[model samples]
Target: MDIGSEYLKIVIKRFKEAKVTAEKAIEQLTESELFWAPNEESNSVAIIVKHMSGNMVSRWTDFLITDGEKPFRNRDDEFMGDIQTKEQMMELWEIGWNTFLNGLKSIEEEQLLKTITIRNEPHSVMQAIERQMYHYSYHIGQIIYVAKFLKSSDWKTLTIPRKK
Candidate 1:
């Protein structure tokens, strides 16, 4: 088997699937619901979206040429939930996802073995991609959870509905 090609295909497929699930979950939330939190320490969907967008844009913007943690990123502010509306959140989300997907598409099979840095920690390109994939998926799960909690019985499932 062509391992590199198979790996690339699998990563791309998983990224697309994750994005679809997150978007579907977001669709069930209204503007108010997007910013609701269960407690002071908990994150709202808006905050999670902000953090994910910030992380994606920072990590992927100059992905191969520089460290994944961009100097200009204000990581702390991402949790503040300052995004005033769903439109703002969606715009940021689209920008971040586009940056990430485009960056991923630009990688060549040979480049996967090249080393990259995130917060000065060295990682292969494949490792970095995998890291972000897991990170984004984790936060997306949180977004779905918060949205579902806010929507209560009205929440729509992003995947196959439970068979009762």
Candidate 2:
């Protein structure tokens, strides 16, 4: 059985689907909406994007050679929602995802069993990818929920339309 190729195919497909889902939510939001949080402690869409993008860059850059958590990443600052414009947010989003996907593409079949670290905890390469996929999807769900709330009546359907 070709476990490695099969795993890569599934991971890539899931990642692509996740990106499309997030983009659908993003399409309904304005710049201000991206930064809107429910309250002082909650995260905004912009903040979620920032955090995920930061994670992507850190985890994927030289993925096999380094810890998934990069030393330069300021995990706290990502929640600050410092991005002032949708353009900047999207650009950063693309930058991080591009880095992640490119890194994923670089992985070989043999690399899946190799050990990696996140915050000094050991994980197989596949385990690390699965971890990020779940983490990013969790944040993307938050982004979609917030965008849907912000759009209110104008919210276009990202999934199946409501029952007639």
Q: Each candidate's TM vs. the true structure?
A: 0.95, 0.95
The RMSD of every model to the true structure, in order and in angstroms, is 1.2, 1.2
The numbered model that scores best in lDDT is 2
Q: Check candidate 1 and list the clashing pairs.
A: none
Where does the lowest 10-residue lDDT sum fall in candidate 1? 143-152
lDDT of 2 by residue, 1-164 (tens): 79898899889988989999999999888877888887999998888889999999999998888888899999998888679899999998999899999988888989898998888899999998999889988998998899889989999988888994
Shift of residue 136 alpha carbon in model 1, Å? 0.8
lDDT of 2 at 152: 91
Error of 2 at 23 (Å): 0.8
